[model samples]
Target: MVSNQNSKNLYQALWSSADILRSKMDANEYKNYLLGIVFYKYLSDRMLVFAVDLLEESASDLEEAQVIFTKAMDDGEVKDDLLYALKDEFSYLIEPSLTFTALVHDVYRGKFQLEDLAQGFRNIEQSNELFENLFEDVDLYSKKLGATPQKQNQTIANVMKELADLDLAHQGDILGDAYEYLISQFASESGKKAGEFYTPQPISELMTRIAIDGKEDQKGFSVYDPTMGSGSLLLNVRRFSNEKGFINYFGQELNTSTFNLARMNMILHGVDSANQHLRNGDTLDGDWPTEEPTNFDAVLMNPPYSAKWSGEKGFLDDPRFSMYGVLAPKSKADFAFLLHGYYHLKESGVMAIILPHGVLFRGNSEGKIREILLRNGAIDTVIGLPANIFFSTSIPTTVIILKKNRPNQDVLFIDASNGFTKGKNQNVLEPNHIEAIIDTYQKRVSIEKYAHLATFDEIKENDFNLNIPRYVDTFEEEEPIHLGELAQEIAATNDSLAQAEKELATLFGELVSTSPEIEKELAQFRQLLHGGGLE
Candidate 1:
């Protein structure tokens, strides 16, 4: 564990590296360089520490560890043995010359070359399937870094120097948190593009809590996020689960760059390669994890809202959507994403998804699909979140909780739209607010104006529209108006106005103009104030 001040220092240190590249490119483009380098440094630092631990030797720091490793590598037998050990432990090898500490030393000596860093990245990617092409998005030769070779080298060197002093090796969770801090800062700067790769942390926490409410203690628990942007939402499960070490993470992303980000995020958080099941592909195009343990204990998603999809007729026969008898509209694949995740949910599992409110009330195919889910008692709860809670968009969104088998068709509606702290850039759900939601959800009881438990007949009464307002009556009747008191107040206001007008008329009467034309105008004004329109 890291102290709060140390965590703050680490976050600032990592974020400051971005300043070197901010002027040259937008956040979306520069984040690859910043994050890739940071991840490489983490791997290098860990490798040096692991080598020291394996040898049972005393090394004061990474610098000393690098020296020992370099001297050991001078002997052919020692070099081969060390390489095998590193490969077996980390599934990768970082040569003494290519380590982050060595690269920084070269930078200070004016001997650093872009190719060395590029080669280091290549070695890691080629080490194992888990790391294959992990650094593909970090393009060292891109003109975006600089126009000439020397300038690009200087640019990369500057960033490396900025990060060289940070203690990424021993700071366990702090290092991963700092990396997340950088990602969030970049997401804030990326604007609408942030939606493709990030979900607000509070929303992630809320969903994770709800999905893993009852089964927090279950061992070998699994969670899946089809649109696992940066894998932050998937990682939140570990935060709230008791079986953190045994939890399995399964996810897929359509964006290759974002997929790489998720992979790095997992490793930075110290997630084991064996426990991580991530794929870089379109989740909706085809089903993945098509093997044993296909379904998960929990499914959490915050997919792109209203994204266009093929919505081909062929999907109707697909097991995921076949039972619905209709496919989600092409213009809005919200339901398509929902059904896909729901299909992979275990019978006893709980799934939570964030989507636009339209899915609750929109008619036609979506309505029919929603009806089927509701009829089957799969739709468990609907939580309305405050607007402006996301960096990507200001529109308010809802979290719909689903379950597989239920005895009743009751749906809990929580109107938490107004329960967030207003922020300068976006609204935020404070801890208390999140707890209130989870408490209400677990209790399954209604609160006045805040929550409501509606029966199946009520939903059918409203034509099966699952809108929050229909279920939770947040409307507060205007405090009954006191007509008699209002009339008295109005009469008092009239009397005060009359008294002020009389005083004004008296003031005008005292104004006597010397010129005849001005006196005539004043007299007419006094006449109007006394009995004409003014009265």
Candidate 2:
């Protein structure tokens, strides 16, 4: 029952102290020390609760024995069995002195080696296989943290001691928020490398809702993002709640570090690992989890735009590409990722992915893939998003929603590029813009200036190019040139020029723009030059 203010306060207490490490070391290096110890503290707190509950259960069972001949209650003799059970339960205890704070405190007092603390972390991780390799060896005491073991220990001590003093209760999403803050801060500082993985939260939220389509009660659901960097897409699905709902998430990432980050992110957000298959492998190689081919409910992906992949090695037999007849080029894997998403999609599931505009009308294998999908009525919706929504890549991307089972044989195309607000660095899709796109998806109805529903034959006639402008007719024809109207417009322009010149002359003569302060100074100058005489 933590209030939002309380959560904010807790975050401020911990994250505000991260500036201490900003000057001493790289933020990415300091992340391990900060997050690793916080995770340790969380583990210890939960374990304490577990042990206390287990002991209480044991004590209740033992007290039922016919040994009620010990301490006297107010009315009569009471059973002593409860006392003995409590003592036995204390044996399975983690000493309070060994808590995360205690270790940090000892480091400040110069009484402990960092190796002991590192071993303590390993032991805590070993305490539960449920969290095996939860952090991918954060190495809080490794040289990566500092210049040497002692220096690393000192840095860790300072960071932990600062964080340990914070009041982060194990109640809600405080940890997740803190972790997200760290990631965002890293994104701001690390530039391209960090930007490659993390999509801004607002953008991610919009993408997830568009893909989920107001379904709230749907469980056993599966969603995915092939380039699931830090799992912003997967986590945002949990934020989706409508009259109908979605249940689970699934994703695969090629970068081992980013893969670990996604898994850690899911865990911090309280998503059960069983419900998410965040495998660490290249998705292009079909290195995805191959157990169940088409059991997913919805698949959403923002695969790296135009990234090179192994797409030319007889990929026609890769199962994902075999039916498409040709693999995408080695340089542009956009169609390849889309085919993989389409391959794993259930018969009724929807696949919405962000791709560069080139993928819509690219000739060759991509065009072939487009023809195959559209011919099968897999193309359901095509949404054009504003440019620069994704980090690292500022190219405007499109969302192609493919449905295996379509109730209609038409495609919905929405042109939203001109519908976004301009920001300082990039264009942004506000909440209303996202809502408008989702509304178009649900309605499948065409609008006058925004969306269009093109028939399958129309797409075929257009050579199967799914570009937004192909279906959505946003062309504004210029008014027919009128000779009389042009002559009148030219006369008006000449009149305006004459009026502007006259206004400028009179305004300069009066000089009314200068105030009384300047007028007083001018009077002094006139007195000095004209000997105080009126003209």
Specify the highest-TM-score model's number.
Answer: 1
Identify the leading candidate in terms of lDDT: 1
Model 2, 1-535: lDDT tens per residue?
1348767766665675576677766765565556666666655444444434533432222122111111111112222343344335322223344655456557678886776666666665565544556666476655555788777767767766666554333545777776776776676566556655687766676667766664656666677677788887777777775421335667788876677677767766766545766677888875475777445667878788898987766777777888877889999988888888888788867677888899889998888888888878888888888777655667788888888867666888888887788877557788788788778878878998799989988888898877777777788999899999999999999989777766655544454326888887765655553442222
Per-residue lDDT of 1-535 in model 1, one digit per residue for the tens? 3569779777777767888899999999999999999999999998998888877777888889898888887878777888889889999999889999999999999999999999999999998999899999999988989999999999999999998987588879988877777788899999999999999888999999888888889989999999999999999998888988999999999999999999999999989988999998888889887898899999999999999999999998899899999999999999999999999999989999999999999999999999999999999999999999999999989999999889999899999999999998999999999999999999999999999999999998989999999888888777989999999999999999888877877788899979999999998888887775444
Give the lowest summed-lDDT range of ten residues in model 2: 65-74
What lDDT is reached at residue 400 by model 2?
Answer: 85
* Runs of candidate 1 exceeding 4 Å displacement: 1-3, 480-535
Q: TM-score per candidate, in order?
A: 0.91, 0.78
